[model samples]
Target: MSRPDPVFPFFLDHPARVTSDRLELLTALVNGPRFDPMFRGDLLVVPPDHPVYRWQCRVGGCERPGQHHVELCFQQDREWAEARASGGNQAEFLEAATRRQHAGWSRFPA
Candidate 1:
């Protein structure tokens, strides 16, 4: 059977516009926010229709000042608590959790 398409869609949508390295950079651009400190601890939940969304990032160190990408807010967040409990069902979830209780994202303010 054919494998599923990759998460990076440039190749399928704009094949003539970019090279492989461009794809790599685009992929990084899309996911890089997942590592910045301010975003790591926040929960990401979208409704079924995905409209009327709420986007929150903690206020702290970031290249774009006033926009935080690293934070310590997760320790008190209820979602964090529940996720940790649920994550325990997965193998070695504690060992795999991020320092700020996030999932594998960096904790540094840089």
Candidate 2:
């Protein structure tokens, strides 16, 4: 007959220890140099203008999350659609686009 796994009993008996160890490992990983500093904090706050991870609407002063594939937020995208239909180019739209207020969520420092 085959013997039972030795690790299962240890984990079952020391769940708190397991949890603490996992947290410790996670903390260490987060504090490590390889991890990006932007995501090291308790609250992840990516900058709107980050070169690699652009998270905000492209329109100036807009505070909405960008839609997938499209850089602009819902309102801006709708506005752009309407403007485009009227023969307005993206450059002109960007120049004349009105500043939008922050989304419902509270603002975090970049």
Colliding residue pairs in candidate 2: none
Mind sharing the TM-score for model 1? Answer: 0.18
- For all candidates, what are the clash counts? 6, 0
Candidate 2 error regions (>4 Å): 1-35
Question: How many times do residue backbones clash in model 1?
Answer: 6
List, residue by residue over 35-67, the lDDT tens digit for candidate 1.
444233456433212123312223222111111
Q: Write down the lDDT of every candidate, Cα atoms only.
A: 0.40, 0.84
Off by over 4 Å in 1: 1-17, 34-45, 48-110
TM, every model:
0.18, 0.60
Indicate the worst ten consecutive residues by lDDT in candidate 1.
59-68
Which lDDT tens digits does candidate 2 get at residues 10-91?
7896877987888999999989999899887778777777888998888888877778687888888999999999999999
Residue 100, candidate 2: how far off, in angstroms?
0.9
Q: Largest TM-score belongs to which candidate?
A: 2
In model 2, what is the error at residue 40, expressed in angstroms? 3.8
